[model samples]
Target: MTAHAPPPHAAPNAASERTERWWHRATGYQVYPRSFADSNGDGMGDIPGITSKLGHLSDLGIGFIWLSPVYASPMIDNGYDIADYRNIAPEFGTLDDMDHLIAEARERGIGIVMDLVVNHSSSLHHWFQAARASRDCAQHDYYIWRDPAPDGGPPDDARAAFGGPAWTYCEEVGQYYFHFFSPAQPDLNWQNPALRAEIYDMMRWWLDRGIAGFRMDVISLIGKDVDARIYEEGPDLHPFLQEMHREVLAGRDVLTIGESWSVSIETGLLYCGRDRDELDMVFEFSHIREGWHPELGKFAPKPFDLVAFKRALFSWQDLTRDDGWHALFLSNHDLPRQVSFYADDRAHRRPAAKTLATVLHLLKGTPFVYQGEEIGMTNARFERIDQYRDLETLNHFEEQIAQGVSPEAFLAGANRNSRDHSRTPMQWNAAPHGGFTTGTPWIQANPNFGEVNVEQDMVHSESVFAHYRRLIALRKESDLVTFGHTVQLMQDDPDIIAFERRLGDERLFVIANFTAQDRERELPQGLAGQADCLVWSHTPRGEIPRSLRLVPYESLAWKL
Candidate 1:
């Protein structure tokens, strides 16, 4: 099943148009290039590593692949602070290697989606260097630069997204520059039309290189606040996005997914509605933010709230059902493993993983699977703070410790929520370093990799990998699972998540018990004895009658 590529500028026909919308029901898998696979025995994953493992994704039954940033970078933010947009990082591979990987992935029925990080560039970037050389340079406006405050202090009191002040003073220019993240990353000046034209040209260059599309990073922040605030939202975002679409993506049969923060139903309509022409899909950061407190950061602990989670999920579903598209996901490169975060990784990892996958996949959106998620990977065990490599985690630990926080408590928080947990090498087998590499991996592998790995799980019928494969199969096989309208059932049951999908008499029910204890729920009207089970997290338990019993973390979907 090789991928079918549409002509570069083909005339619109019914079949071609339908094919253009193929991403609506597609299952996308995200591969963090540095952790996916290491083909060169250099302890770091690269484009060749991903190309060598294309068969694994094909075997897992994914339609598209999303590769995290491999662009030329100083690795200050692990490639997010890109130094060059058009070139591949030396650690990842060369331009030829990237082109080869794209071609190989297409041959295996996998469309490649590169990570686009245009919000900021590495301080080492030529443009940033030129901007910092002198304020009178032509490229001075390429990045956001401002004069110091009245009393010869820092610029406006905006805080960085990671922590601390957003402005960094430069002695050479005698001014301050704003960076939403690290000082090594300076935000681009999207208000400059010349910079916008340069970005559009770069996108066209990639599209012409036979790559499919992009997963834009912090794209919402591209629209700056008129008052120079550091917030994620702005008023002029739509116009910029619209112009981008018209200039670069008007006729290309490609997908553009944005990491949009502070999203609402109104924002969804403006960003992803069929008529908006801004983006194909946007990832709203509501449910993923459930475990963190408003004042406390990700390092701080907050008990998971089931009601809040459900409310956010349903709100997005209802909002997008009519006019917009969503990019559904649980775990990504930035967060801990979903099963470990949401379920008991020690007791019921398999069933919990399956339940999460079923609920997200059966919903009305495109599903995204982060690398190693298929095999129930747990969070990394970094007992000491020194074991962590993420800049955000390390800097946060230092900041909190300086502010009178205990090292013991801070390490505990970092162990629980650090991004390094998700950056561990992929568990290919039970060999040394989980068969991820013959040499030492850049980061440590999870100790549980011996039990939870691709080789062992791929052959096990009840493994999380097999369960995800079945769910993806159902999504491709059933129309109701793909395009049906969603309705919540048994909304008052806090332990049970039940939903109905209906598409012109093709009715389907998805019910799951999210806890480790068995739950029994009264069946809805017309559902009892009418269900023919299609997919289940556990073995079939006969027919779903008037009173249905769901095992621990069990999820089942049936056709009526």
Candidate 2:
């Protein structure tokens, strides 16, 4: 699969014709602050370190950075448990550093999107502390609390997402508080008007600081009805979202992306529908979940089924075709590396990474590049559970081991799906600690950084980073790539993932081989012809042949 000598079409001037939002044609890059880079020899990445690395992101041509949480915390859940919303974590630097990072990133046309973890606050947060100390305080009503059951146990047998019971007893208050995640993180009571007002005010404060927007953490659980065990997309969800929009997001030219683990195609539009005014997009997990064991969940691994994965992915594309927008991503701070999880990381790492990026970036949505993903990072195949740092992974290890699961068996699963795979220090160069820190890293860097670092990839001809740079540039210049409607092809083909992007008469066809073996796929009659080559992974060709033979992990895009 290749292209002819026909020159690519002139860059489209569609911005003047359409009232497009800044993000519609932009690409997002997520920065897990703790693992990105370390300055001051602290062994932990900070805002100053992130500021120093802006040139790398600028070179990649990202429009925004979805920075993971760096708020004041006790280091539980890797900063997801927020202790203070308005301040920065001491380990991550100060508020001045954050302001500087925003200013510096803005100078390079990259907006910094902060992580909003309003669904819960750290147990150490002042509000939570006050709430737990006294049931008579105003803050007591700011969190979900209920009386103990007749048997003096929890209000219900609900389980936390990390592990153990969801309800934690507050002896001082003589009641139990609900937490969807770890007990160290207490659920916020969105039903309380005062609590809502405080959240709105905090959001306004951040927006006033000139940050881009927010990538909301577990937003679907905000309107949970704990009494009924309805934690996801509850009845009050939209109303609360609508209220939040009215208060904080309505007139602001900022992007808001809600993260929903349970958002399905059936209820997709409710969050990002054109008229909904709730969120610009959602980080839904239907496609990612398809790779997990059904009943056993993420810990227990399952074989990657390409067909089912396509169905889940393309379904969202279909759902957002004419209505809501999509948030394109494969890896994140909470997920395993894309090359290791989705494709052949060991043998075909570079091409497979490029192929994955090709399929995702060409889709009609704002694509996100996780830190180190552009360089084809692999999983931290830790042999022991102690090598892991994620609370979710560590807690699950204990639970599974206690349930008669062997330590070796649990370690195998953790190696495949642990969040720490993506949390390892970013591979910057071949230097010690992957050049991420001057001191010992808080988490051990992937040992393969010597072979798969950004500096190394930038010099290679077949570079994943280079491929991503081209894709990002293509989105910014090509109107067809930005607004074209997606039409999935070869949905049933297990070895091939193909799709067409059509905007009026302009068409961009993309195809990728998802296997380690050579694959011969019959191109659709309408798609076979001489065309300008948009991008290719393995070899550049002269034309789109009727019978296309793709090398292992080869990907190509043709604009016709």
The candidate that wins on lDDT is: 2
Candidate 2 wrongly placed segments (more than 4 Å): 1-18
Off by over 4 Å in 1: 1-20, 226-230
Q: Model 1 compared with the native: what TM-score? A: 0.96
Model 1 pairs whose backbones collide: none
Report lDDT per candidate.
Answer: 0.85, 0.90
- Using all chains and alpha carbons, the TM-scores for the candidates as numbered come to 0.96, 0.97
Cα lDDT of model 2 by residue, 313-359, tens digit: 99998898877889999999889999999999898999999999999
Best candidate according to TM-score: 2
Cα deviation of 518, candidate 1, in Å: 1.5
